[model samples]
Target chain A: MSENKTVLYSYWRSSCSWRVRVALAYKKIKYEYKAIHLLKDGGQQKTEEYSKINPMKAIPTLEIDGHIIGQSLAILEYLEETHPENPLMPNGAYERAIARQMMQIIGSDIQPLQNLKILGLVGQYSGDEAKKAEWARTIITNGFNGLEKLLEKHSGKFCVGDSVSFADLCLPAQVYNANRFNVDMTPYPNITRVNQYLLTIPEFIEALPQNQPDAEPQC
Target chain B: MSENKTVLYSYWRSSCSWRVRVALAYKKIKYEYKAIHLLKDGGQQKTEEYSKINPMKAIPTLEIDGHIIGQSLAILEYLEETHPENPLMPNGAYERAIARQMMQIIGSDIQPLQNLKILGLVGQYSGDEAKKAEWARTIITNGFNGLEKLLEKHSGKFCVGDSVSFADLCLPAQVYNANRFNVDMTPYPNITRVNQYLLTIPEFIEALPQNQPDAEPQC
Candidate 1:
């Protein structure tokens, strides 16, 4: 597995994909970006070839040294383990658990409900964009507000105790995605502040959807 | 923080709450159970009193030695750390990653979409149990299938390489919840077998929702 090249099966606009992309860059791991256009070809994630790579047919499957890892949090941890020099978690066990808690809020609690695929399903099943949007807004607000309160206790320029842990790598893309759906963040002052600070960094700025190699707007 | 008693604020039927309950029992960590019924009186989780304890207004909030932890997966890791005697993760870095990866599939992937609160919302907005059931089945099947494949590579009597890690602690409750919703598990042979095996063990058996002190037949 060590001799093989690194490749990422990803979509430029996928928030989960973006999280993995930023983590790879943060750890300075060089890899090939194989863009799987999610919208085109009736969601390329469902294709046989792609499904072979990931049975779940989800974007952002990381192929490192031929060992494939799916799930963004798992991929991020794999990168951290294989490249421990740039740790995405804190030093102590308690601190690391706290960071994982923050990452969980965005990864499990918030992102899944607001994902493009789920939203598309809502469109098909209910034909109630207004209702779906309200659902999205309520959960996003609940998640962010919980995150905001938790951040109040531990955040110091970053989601954890100042250093850029996995939490920082996850939050911005999600907040960005939420705004696109008109889920306002002005009520979430801490999220807005942390996101603003993250945007100023070159790694995060470069990892934004508009700045990706296959980005649409070419930011 | 280590001196205070461990208190768990949980709902009887919540899969998220069950994840933490199983983890604590696995580690033999003593705790107080404070049940907050999610369905009673327009959801007890929405109360300002409970919200103060957890801004997410979610159940399974663990107050360990005065430190409050909300997310179930995070709380489980905290248990593993504080009581490392019965270690939940394997020793090797790669093995540990695989264990966490499995937990993420259940904790982050399957459990979130089919959570009781989300189903309540689906009932409220869509007013159709059949449609809500379909959505639950779709995501849970996708999650379990991904897990079954990963287990193909990672399993050895347990979710990881032989030991009952956090991943094992997470699975039974998930499969049970899926069964409650009538999602057939005959397709995933490995998962069904492992879940059946875990059921015989006393720790897991004690943590089963039907066996819990507060578990109502309706919950």
Candidate 2:
């Protein structure tokens, strides 16, 4: 029973956390969610208990039979491997590379610059909300421009060669993050199309930050 | 004969380029190196010819059998898949996840913040070399700290439960990058020890940036 059980420590609004949630749901793996608010008391992830589970003290830590795993991309690969039934990666080596490349574009190229801590730095140093927004927008637009060009050549029904690879799991959350800063998604038809398609998927739909149990309802 | 050839478009000093170089050598694959000087004349990677090969215009774009691949982690995985004779990843899915996580730490979490362009941003917007260095130090410290804790638990002969995964390829370049800014490696025993062991491996030793044909001769 312990071996079959999986648990994820996640924040309700974290894009990284959302990526894992989408992956788990896509794989149809049942797991327990332990919410750690990133804002309350200066982030509950800083707690001693959480540190023991993940020294980075970040969210979307997966526990499989008590073995802890951190990092959203790592967690997705783990889920894909553990549950190979509904394969996220394609059959060929090149295809897999294309899939992972798209994932990296968002995971590495875009997300880090706009992360909470980095944005905090922008706020403190720049002291201009518009400047911070522009800073965030610059990286997102740069990354997405590259992604759009690449997707222009390779995208089919999804990122990569048509199948719903792990890259698909990443698109919505990343698009959502960009939207938070008012990044004009209108420029990239490929990205907008993929995001719209991803929204229709049951797994991706349920993993939306707004759909979380801890979501703050809008007035 | 063309299909049998593997060519890597790389800059000798680029950390991302080094990742693919080490992987190619580790797999014992013979390939051609096309040097694209990243810093000369406003960057050779920005050229139209290179952009045709890689939309991202990044270092370490790999061409194998007429097919192209980009992104360090993606290329490494591609090499692992196409040439399974020399396995870099561990046997189990969970262990493989651990390896990917370490790569993500280096690739996603750490590298971007320290890139030439980001440092330029710091200098441009934040207004000082000192501030840029401080920003670089902060993220490097944060990433290394997170990785050190992770390595404490997971490392054996190498990061991610041993046997030279992609994590081994990632660590050296990052450690080297930090040292370029004078970040002390002595602070990390695990990282230091692993890097020492990796240096002993002929493949890694052979792929050092200083050894490449395009490496500038320093007086």
> Among these predicted structures, which one has the highest lDDT?
2
RMSD after Cα superposition, model 1: 2.1
lDDT of 2 at A23: 79
iRMS, candidate 2, in Å: value is: 1.2
Clashes per candidate, residues 3 or more apart or on different chains: 0, 0
Residue B193, candidate 1: Cα error in Å is 0.3
How do all models score by TM-score? Answer: 0.94, 0.96
Predicted candidate 2 versus true structure: per-residue lDDT over B70-170, tens digit per residue: 88888988888888987888897877888888888889889988898788877777766678877788888888988988788889979977688988999
TM-score of chain B of each: 0.93, 0.95
Which candidate should be chosen as best, given TM-score against the real structure? 2
Q: Report how large a share of the reference interface contacts model 1 reproduces.
A: 0.62
True-structure lDDT of candidate 1: 0.81
Tens-place lDDT per residue, model 2, A1-219, is 266678888887898999888878877888888889998989898898888877777887998855678899998888777788878788887888888888888898888888887888776666565678888898899899889988888888888776888788889878887888899988799989878888988988889888887888753
Worst 10 residues of 2 chain A by lDDT: A122-131
